[model samples]
Target: MSEFADRIRPHAPTRDDASARRWIYVPYDRLTDATGPLTEQPASQTGIVMMEALAKAHRRPYHKKKLALILASQRHFALKQARRGIKIIYEFTPGIFADGLEQATRHHRLSALTMMQPAEREMSLDVEEARVRGIPLQLVEDTTWCSTESDFDSVFAPTTKHFLMDRFYRRMRQKTGILMQPNGEPIGGKYSYDAENRRPYRGQPPVPERPRFHPDSITQEALHLVAREFPSHFGTLDGFDLPVTQAQADEAWSFALEHLLPHFGPFEDAMAHNEPDLFHSRLSALINISRLLPRRLIDDVARAAHSERIPLASAEGFIRQILGWREFMRHLHRRTDGYRQLPGQRNNSSSDDPYAGAEPSALNAHRPLPAAFWGRRSGLHCLDTVIDQVWREGWSHHITRLMVLSNLSTLLGVSPRALTDWFWIAYIDAYDWVVEPNVLGMSTFADNGLTATKPYVSGAAYIHRMSDYCGHCRYNPRKATGDASCPFTSLYWSFLDRNADNLSSNPRMSMPYVTLRKKPASELNELRKRAAQAIEELCHAQQASPQE
Candidate 1:
C-alpha cells in the first residue's frame, strides 16, 4: 500500500454488517450533481454529510449577502436531496469545517467520507490533514469545469516558461467545438471579439430591468440566521436577490439570454454613475456555486449565435469568459498554488533599486488599502460610487473591478495581499481559485508576465473615456498636480515614474515610457508630491473608518 493509503485506515466491517456505512460530504460551494462522489456512488447505499460550519464562515469579515447566499444554497440543496429519499446527516456545528467533518465522521462510524476536491488550496490541505489523522477521507474528481487538466496541458506544460491566454483559449475552443465552423475555423473568422467589445454605453439602447427573486422560506431563514450571527459583517442583506436553488438560477439564466445577451458585448467595458448591472449577465455567482454548469451555458450561447437570435459578438464574448478566462484562471491557480510561491522567484535581479525587475507583489507597494473599499466615503465620485454599488449588491462587472478598484489600488501602491483578500471577501463570485490569479497576476501584475503581458495601470483618461464618473466629480481628470487634481491622474504618473526602470524594457510599455521621458523633472516632482498627498489622505480615511 502507498503511504497515503496506509495512513487512512478503512472502517472495519462488523460480522453482522454486510457493508460499512459510507457518506458523501458536500461543501457549501459544491451544491450540484455535476461533480464529486455524489455522481459515482449509488444513492441507496450512500449517506450525505452537510455542514453549516459557522466557525469557518466567521474567519473573515465576509459580506453578509455572500454568507446568506452560500448557507441558503446548501440548506436548499440538502432539502432537495432529502426529498428524493437520500439519507442526509445535516450538522450545524459551531467549529471549523475540518473539526465538524471529523466529529461527524467519528460519530457516524462511516467506512469512508468521500468529497469533491476543494477549490481552495487551504481546504485541500485540510482534507489531507484529516486523512493523515486516521479519517477515511477520499477526494473524487471535480467535474464542474468545462475544460479538463489535459486540455490545459496541451496548451502550456508545467515547464513552459511563457503562456498566452489566447493560445489556451484556442485549444479549449478546438476541444469543445464551441463557436467553431465545420472546417475548424472560428465562426466570425476571428478567435476573439474583445477589440469590438469595448464601446462605451451612451444611453441609446435602454438597459433592461432584471428579474428579482422573492426570498423563499429557506432563503428567508438563512438571511435571518446571517443577520443574527454576522450582524457586524460587511454589506446588508436587505436587497439580497441572489438565486439559492437550481430552479432560480435557471430562471436568472433565461432572463439573461432574453434581455442581457444582445447588448452584453458592446457595453461590457463601460461604467455609468448608477447603473451597476448594466447589460451584465450577473450569472457569475450562480455559476461559481455550481447551481448552473459552465458547459450548458456555453452550449446555449453558441446555439443562440448560430441561430442569429443574438449577435455573434455577444455570444462569443460571453463564451470566452467561461471557456477562456474562467477555465484559464482555475488551472493557473491550481498550478501556482494561489501564487504564494510565484512572487520574488520570477524577478530576482540583484539591484539596489527595489522595482528594477520586481514582480507585481514585489513592486514595493506597501500602502494599506483605504477605508473607501469598506463603504466609507471617499472624496472621489468614481471610488465612492463603485464601492457603494459593491457594498449594496456584492457585485460589479469585470471592467469596474479591474479598472476602478484594482487599477487605483495598483497606482496607489497598496499591498497585493491586502487587495487579494479584499476581493475574496467583498465579492459574491470571488473564490480563492478565481480571485488570486486575477488580483495578483492580471490586475496587479504581481506575477510579472505570467498571466498578463503588461501591467493594467492606467491614468484617469482611460476612466474618463470608459465611464461618466469624471463629469460628476469635483476633481479634474486632466490635472496631475494641485489640490483639485484627480488622484488617479496624479498616482498614475507617479506609478509610471516610480517604476520606469523596471517597465521601460518591455516593448508594450514603450509608448508610456516615451511620454514619461519627455516630461520635465519639475513637473515629475510635483506629480510625485501630489501622489504622496493622495496616499496620506487615503491613510487618514482608513484610520477614520467606521468599521475600525
Candidate 2:
C-alpha cells in the first residue's frame, strides 16, 4: 500500500454493519446524480466518498465565495446522501485528491471504485493516478452535460476546418428539437435572436430584484471552514447566499423564469453602476455544481416560451447561452487540446514586426498582468466597478466580462495565460475547461481567431454606446492622446497600428485597416507613445499598491 493509503480513516459511515463492495467517488461538481451507480448497487453494498482536498483549494487562491459554494454544496450533498441510507465517507485532508480517494478506498476496504467522468482534466488525472496504483476504477458517462463528447465529435468529424459555434448550435437545436417548428425548422423563422438582445437599459420598465437565499447552519459551517483556511483569498463572504440544495436551486430558477426572463433578452448586454446581474439568470454556479441540470433548465425555458409565459426572443437567447455557447465552448476546449499553442503560431511572416523580421518577439506575450485585476482601482470607472463587483460577489454578467475586462486586457496586451488564470480564480462559475477557451479564444483573441472570426477589441466608442460607464468616467471617450484621453481609445488605435502587418490582410478587419491607414504617421506614433505611457503608469500603480 502507498503512503497516502496509510492515512485511511473513515470519519463517517452510513452503517457500521454495511458490507460495502463498491465505492462511488462523488466530485463536488456532480452533486445531483443520484440515479447513477449510487442507485444501481444496494445502499449497503455501496459507499460514497467526498473529499476536501486542501492542496487543490490553494492551487491559485480562489475567491472566497467560490470556495464557500463548492465546499458547502459538497458537504450538503454528502449529508443528503447520508440521509438516504447510503454509505458515505467524507475526508478532509491537506493532501491531494488522489490521496483522498486512495485513503477512502482503503479505509472502507472497497473492491471497486466508480465515478462519473469529470468535466475537468485535472480531476480526470486524479482518477488515472488511482488506476495506476492497482485500484479498479470504472469511469461512467457524466450525464450532467446536455451533449456528450461523441455528440460533439459526430458533428465536427466530417468537417476538416475548425468548428463554428453557430453551425453546431443549429445542429443541437435540431438534435434536441428545441425551439423548432413542427416541420423541423427553427421557431420564429430564424435560429438566432441576437440582434434583438442588444437593446440598452434606459431605466424604463425597471429591473426586478433577484431572490436571495440565506445560508443555513450547514452552509455557515462551510463558510467558517473556508474563512479559516483561505483568509487571504479574493472576494468576500459577507453576501455569500448561493443555493446549496436542489430545492433552493429550483426556487432560484423559478424566480428567474417568472420575473427576469421577460426582459432578459433586450437588456442581457447592458451594464450599469450597482447592477451586477441585470435581468440575467445567476444560475451558472448552481448549474455547474449539478444543483440544476442543463437539459431540465432548457426544457423549462422552452415550455415557458411555447406557452407564451416568456417571449420567443427571451427563450431563444437563454437557450443559446446554454445550448449554443456553453456546449460549443466545451466541445471547442476538448477539440483544440485546451488551446495549448504558442502565441506566434497565428501571426504570418508578412505581419511580423519590421524590426523583429519574420518572428514576433515572445516579449509581446510576456507582459505581467496588473494588480487592478484584483480589485485595485485603475482610476477607470468601468474597470474599477467591474473588478470591485468581482471582489465582492465573484461574478459579473457576460457583457462586462467580454466588453470591459477582456477588451481592455487584450488592448493592454496582458499575457493571455495570466488573464486566463485570473478569470479561473475569480469567478464562481469558472472551471478550467470553460475559462481557457473563453479567455484565450473569444475574449482576448489570443488563439488568434480559432474560436472568434475577428478579435473582440473595441475603442471607448462601443463602450460608451453600450453602457452608462462612460457617464462618470474622468477620461474622454472621444480623445485618443490628451491627458483625459480614455485608455481604451488610445490603445484601440495603437493595437490596430502595432498589429497592422498581421491583421491588414484579414477581410473582416479591412475597415479597421483602412481607418488605420488614413491616420497620419505622426498621429499613429503619438497613439503608440500614449498607449505605452498608460500601460507603464498602470503597471507602476499595481507595483506600488499590491492590494486594493
**lDDT top scorer:** 1
**For residues 48-112, what per-residue lDDT tens digits would candidate 2 score against the true structure?**
78898998898777889999999888877877666665666778779878888778777766667
lDDT of 1: 0.80
Alpha-carbon deviation at 55 in model 1, angstroms? 1.9
Residue 39, model 2: Cα distance from true site in angstroms: 4.7
lDDT of 1 by residue, 106-197 (tens): 77676677888787665776677678778888887788888778888888877875567899999999888999999999998999999989
Global lDDT of each candidate: 0.80, 0.79
Off by over 4 Å in 1: 1-22, 34-36, 343-360, 540-548
TM-scores, all candidates, are 0.92, 0.91
Show model 2 residue runs off by greater than 4 Å: 1-11, 14-22, 39-46, 158-161, 341-364, 544-548
